[model samples]
Target: MNQPSPKRRGRFITLEGGEGAGKSTQVEGLKRFLEDQGIALVTTREPGGTPVAEAIRGLLLSRDHPAMHPDTELLLMFAARAEHLRTLILPALEAGRWVLCDRFTDATYAYQGGGRGVDPARIAALEVWVQGPVRPDLTLLLDMDVKTGLARARGRSEADRFEQEAVEFFERVREAYLERARSEPARYRIIDASRSVEAVAGDLQQAVSSLMGTGQGT
Candidate 1:
């Protein structure tokens, strides 16, 4: 019998930020940029991507419900994440398609732990339990002041559950994300998102160039 060919694992890149930090906009531009390079990739978002996960996202974001407990919110996040990983993200990577995510575990630590005042240790425990060794190879942190980001978000449309949070809550969340980037320098690139869209896109291209290396497989 012939031996099977070894797999080509794809790179996992994530974009993380506070509300209205233009993550979705940037992710769109970044996705297009990477695809223009001829790299096969899947662009998805956390708490979503699969049917089950999308339902969970609805629950998490819906304002129709009474205020959900932090513990419940945390578990739901990982639950959706588990589904997204197994059914979508992981398989794409195993098939040599790079994964570009809007948010990942870092958002958990930021929103649930830092914003909700839950213990980081608890979130870490869930992170280990749910994800094991899986993590983003590169995480781009879009840094902006919480108030400005929230203003931008509000201007767009109605606030969701997470978006309904107060300025102080988001302040803590921003601090949490920044702190994570500080601790994991190699895996993270912080971009100032307060700049104009074109400028921000320029930095995004520059930052991702590190992973681009000489060509796609790099």
Candidate 2:
């Protein structure tokens, strides 16, 4: 009898949010939680996770440069995503190391599609071309009031190009995220990000607990 090799591909988990949703903070906490559970994983962020993609991330975020056209911006986003997928995300998942990401294509849908007025259908087309069937097994969206989120962002650091957009822009971004979550409840776990750090982390652990055995954590 021919023997088949064991394959336990790692789960892909993504954390998504609007400005000041504390995704960065929760990412670290989730990393620690997973470690405590003896689950091996790597954490990375979108528009980055590789040298080439990071360069593109710089261009996307920098206000020092002239603004990119909407179409150009969308293309650049996928360009970075292509590099990130090939170089980091796909490899980690293939090697059976779980992947915890700060953001992913969903951000593009929220930011570029919703905020910038790019068509979601167009984004979907690029998604298919660039990613094939790859998608997060689970997405944790830290949701909160738009104004509060912006205030938190402002307090943390200088506004980047995306951050500098008006509150209306972020409102669209939030709504888009909500719509996606609504459309795909099975893949998404929405968190109340307005709560304290400990509270949010607790909810995050609960959100991912099912993936440990019963499924859905990934």
- Residue 152 shift from truth in candidate 1, angstroms: 0.6
What tens-digit string does per-residue lDDT give for candidate 2 at 70-182? Answer: 99999999999988987788777778788999999999999999999999999999998888777888899999999999999999999998998989999999999999999
For model 1 the local lDDT of residue 152 reads 96
Among all windows of 10 consecutive residues in model 1, the one with the lowest summed lDDT is: 1-10
The whole-model C-alpha lDDT of candidate 1 against the native structure comes to 0.87
> Which prediction has the highest TM-score against the true structure?
2
Checking candidate 1 for backbone clashes, the offending pairs are none
Cα-based TM-score, every candidate: 0.93, 0.94
Regions more than 4 Å wrong, model 2: 1-8, 214-218
Q: lDDT per residue, candidate 1, 11-109, as tens digits? A: 889999998889898888888898998878899998798999999999999998758999999999999998898888878888889999999999999
> What lDDT does the true structure give each of the candidates?
0.87, 0.89
Stretches of candidate 1 off by over 4 Å are: 1-8, 214-218
